[model samples]
Target: MVTRREWLLASGAVAAALALPARSAFAQPARTVKVAIGQKTIAPNLVNLLIGEGLGYNAAEGFKAQFMTVGGVSNAQVAIDRGDSDISTGVPSFALPILAKGEWGKAIHFYQYTYPYKWDVAVKPESTLTSYEELKGKNIGVPDFAETAFPVTKNVLRSLGLDPDRDVKWTAVGTGVAAGVALQRGAVDALAYYDTGFGQIEGAGIPFKMLPLPKNVPMVGGQFLMALRERIAKDRDLMVGYGRSVAKASVFLAASPRAGARAFLKMYPEAAPRGSSEEDAIKSVLLATARRIKLYDPPYAGAKIGSINPEEFRIEAQMNDMKISSFDAFLTNELIDEINSFDREEIKRQALAYA
Candidate 1:
């Protein structure tokens, strides 16, 4: 026989015991993966990564991604080479030369972001440069002579019957805003870079005219996720996990890009400078996301989000004049196939539910 107080105390103890296990069950710690990005600022591509993290996609794959910004792809590669980062984003055309020369450890490209040869040659709005033909003998600013932009731009010029070496002058201007400054100051007659570079220039309120690359030229490769071959062999599970997480994020972005913008701003509030409206920042991000989404359609026909088209790689290698015994030396499809193995319908449903 127990008093009323004694009965209440027993009930409270039972409740505590039941709740403790539930809390512990939900509290699993996540593993951390360091990602080194080429650009210092938060672009739409970075926003997709951030949204994936915010939505626990990375954690679901047993990873907690930490993104570090080095100045350029070269810098990001240096960081990875030094073992300061686990993975880095870069262009295969740029990395291949280094790999061919044995300057860096062999790497595996696990993901593809943009289609090759998507760069545009742009000029000031008031300028008379209307065709690639006119660019001959004109100063064209590229991010780097050794990077993808230079070779792609050269191919475009060659296609137009212009001698890249003798007819056009190439200048290595810094990326995005810096390149825009070169154009604004009349330092370069034209600027050739990725869509993001042109986006940055337009976003800064400087109107510009762009000449699109010809569709006939073989597609050069685009940006990709790379890790040392040794790391991939040792940590295959982690690489597969990253692919799975990013695949889901890609579907989510395609379904709802606005949600991506909101997530980006929430994760990095500093992206919006002082006196700028949240709405404006969100719009900017959405625009960037839209551009990225376009890169996934049509030319890149596939179900897997990060699928690397072998033909694209072959074409890129040919364009860059590099010899590769096998494409497998640089890329692997195992992880991407695993990522696509997830229920496609369910992924689409999740993306649609973002709104």
Candidate 2:
């Protein structure tokens, strides 16, 4: 297994790329908002986030954005709980368990950045595992045990009437080349991962036959931007403005995913693999992120982004065998209107006119 220390030593580019200078706007912000995410590499689903930074969406909203890279979601939550970071990124299902503890002190999942979970369970082309039932007693691979993929896989197994803990074994295969290599060498039977994980593997020439999400599963509300309740109450402008900036970036990226991929490439050139061509790098990112881009567009009838869908989380709670006292405790739609109050047509025009 690739250790975290080894991974960090090899990821100097990722660290260097994150040392971004603050974008300039007509008015400077009062303070820097530290936003944490549980990733080292630039995943496809984060195309909108990169675009948001690249295009000065945060600066336009009157704040400076600092992207912080941490070990995992659990760590990211700790960062927020300990007052180290203001906001963290993660999906709804995987977050349910951590949020249920109430130990995080009223952390609110205020922003819905991506939705209709573009997650998958898959097997190698030669594997005979075609259904969830077949997954019983089999080992599964995930990027990491701390990620949403593992819990989602466990709950998916539960939906199939199998004991997730006893009936299945899970292994952390790592991500990018490490994950693909694990699957290639038969380190695990099947992979329970998101679109970006699968796309990168396929991009490396390892194909998979995706197992369909069980009928009982509700794969909506992919990922969220979470912040502490006190922070939201005290820093309402920063919270809402950041969401608005992300909404604008999401709109622009969703309007033209290819353009978004191109923009990401230009913004973070180090994102590409050392020897990969620009065209190949674009294809790799697009392959991983294209399906997710569709969900970036506002799903609500009002054409607004970042609106929390509690019902989806409720179903997610049921599927994951997690208990929630109340959805409103951790979810909110109070800022949806302000978040979506942007001129989306202009974003589309900019997307279309990308040079």
Candidate 3:
């Protein structure tokens, strides 16, 4: 029979053992974060995120990525607000209204796909319209009046000394094929859309010339990685990992967009554009990736790949006619320092090695 002293000694030993730092047999597994993209259809920009997942970059950073596709930017924001997703991607234009209404939290821009604007006004190859001035009194087809493309195009026209509301007639035509068709049928004299739209038109055997926006205008549009303020506060490390993975993927894209496209196709073959063969899909992604790559060559005012410039946000707000009490209220660079911490040369090496 055990004595009281022996029982006391046993209890002490058990307590000491419990205090030891031993791995638990039933420890919880690492988490997988769900991320949503703004559009239901995957575009070339999303290919980088896919490449990062396929390459295990996110895993290396200590979490797994589960991508979720939503109907549009508003849906993506709703996913986060409803706690269905932890992160989402979209333009600040989409996020601004949400933030204004207190419907969501801040936007953290991780990808600077273009400066000033991503979309442009384009005319037929043989059309005599040579400049923004020529666009006056002409009908310009845009993706949607409510979308960023419309206001951005209007701003560009304003910078060109034309009143977008009065001098130019704006028509709502859908993107890609629809806008291309409008241009082809003379429904609109020019189409204001992204480079991808131009690619779509040219690939369909139509020739066009892009009307350049003035370089002196402030940077007005780009994409962003966003999360609710609560989520960002609680899961900063996860966001950092996400930023790092995407930064590495951007390097991979810059090195070889074709490889990025291949990885994307391997993961999501269904993302192939409508009516496109696998080869055509790859070509389309390559073309889109090439254009995005140019935006990073100088790296957005020499900042790191994922860094956001406060002044740029001010300009964007002005262009959108958004009134903000503070830029910090809507944007943050908290994760950028960590994302840019990796050795760029090493990132390039790994990117080149991605099969």
Candidate 4:
């Protein structure tokens, strides 16, 4: 059964993208565009610039992409609203209510569905922790107090008949890396982190066990790609160009995982090893990154994965049962389709190269 959020988001996005007039407006030169990356370090979302920056795709299309750490999804939304950034990429579920507040108004449409590979609980490998019920009365650390991690953690706890508030003491440890360090140091009994952060801990030689979420619990709602709705409305070509850049990045990432991982490590040296060959470490990073990205692949061929579609409605229903307000806020593919058409040949070429 389709959930309300999927219907709402998809219908709204499609309607908005389709309603735009096709006539070209005034000519404008390339402008420096700023993007707000909510996360502290580089990840797949930066795949656009990681590839585009090196390949001059953004320049070829007409914009220089600038990135900065902007705290949580709310922070990125506020930044974009206050004109601190032009685009913001992060968790979509948390951003919806803010978007409904007209934060960026008609200037942005939330596009792109990132997978839910970012949230999980890890325990020290030495601990005999094999299940969620085993975590009762433990100290759990998460990046933020009110973020989705907390809720997901609560959901899991509830499913295991554990009250998170009463059974477990939760702390906000700031970054996943910090959480990993804390867990390794025995400061926290367990750390709630995502796939990449978990990769870091494993890479650091810390053996940890991931606690399985309850079978009935919902998969964490994924990240989103949001743009300035006004910019898209006023400058269709620029919007199309931005979309093309994203596609190019995704294709390159799929085609050249190792090279992509190398680029990723270059943007984030902290993600690489000190003595390992850059190529080897990058290949490791790329293999891991590719695995995570596959979770976001849309069901359709060459389709954007991980976004709200028919498959997520049931999850949304579960969220509603958990008291999450459900509405018609599904992610729409109209803009992506439009953008894909403009650069379909290039995308196909890159995909072929990667294949």
lDDT of 4 by residue, 1-355 (tens): 2233433333322222211111111232358666766554555434544455544556667876666555445555555555666666655455444434433243344455455545678888897787778778788888676355765567567656787779989888766456677888888888886666566556556677887765765554666666656655666666566656666666666666665665566546665666778766775575446455555455445555323453443453354343334333434455766555545456546545531
TM-score (C-alpha, index-matched) for candidate 4: 0.74
Candidate 3 per-residue lDDT, tens place, 1-355, comes to 1222332333322222211111221322387777776553555656666667777777678776777656455556556555666787656665554444454444444444344446778887788987888888999998775456776677677766788899989898876667788888889999888665566566666677887666775576676777777777888888888888888877777777777877777666765777898889888777656666666433454577777776766666666566766766666777778877888798778667866
RMSD for all candidates, in order, please: 15.0, 4.9, 14.5, 8.5
Give a tens-digit lDDT track for model 2, residues 1-355.
Answer: 2232333353443333343433443354667788877665556667776567667677777777777767566555555655667887866654565556543356788888877666788888899888988998898998987677887677667767899889989899998767877877899998888877777777878876888667856554368888888888998888998998888888887777778888787767777767999898888888877677778755557645787778777877777656778776777788888787888899889888877
Q: TM-score of model 1 relative to the true fold? A: 0.82
Minimal lDDT window, size 10, model 1: 17-26
Is 1 or 3 the stronger prediction by TM-score? Answer: 1
Model 2 TM-score (2 dp): 0.87
Q: What residue pairs clash in candidate 3, if any at all?
A: none
Off by over 4 Å in 1: 1-28, 102-104, 144-148, 159-161, 297-303
Which has the greatest lDDT?
Answer: 2
Structure candidate 1, residue pairs in collision: none
Per-model TM-score, in order, reads 0.82, 0.87, 0.81, 0.74
Error of 4 at 11 (Å): 31
Error of 3 at 258 (Å): 1.8
Number of the predicted model whose TM-score against the real structure is largest: 2
List ranges where model 2 is wrong by over 4 Å: 1-30, 98-104, 298-303
lDDT of each: 0.67, 0.73, 0.67, 0.57
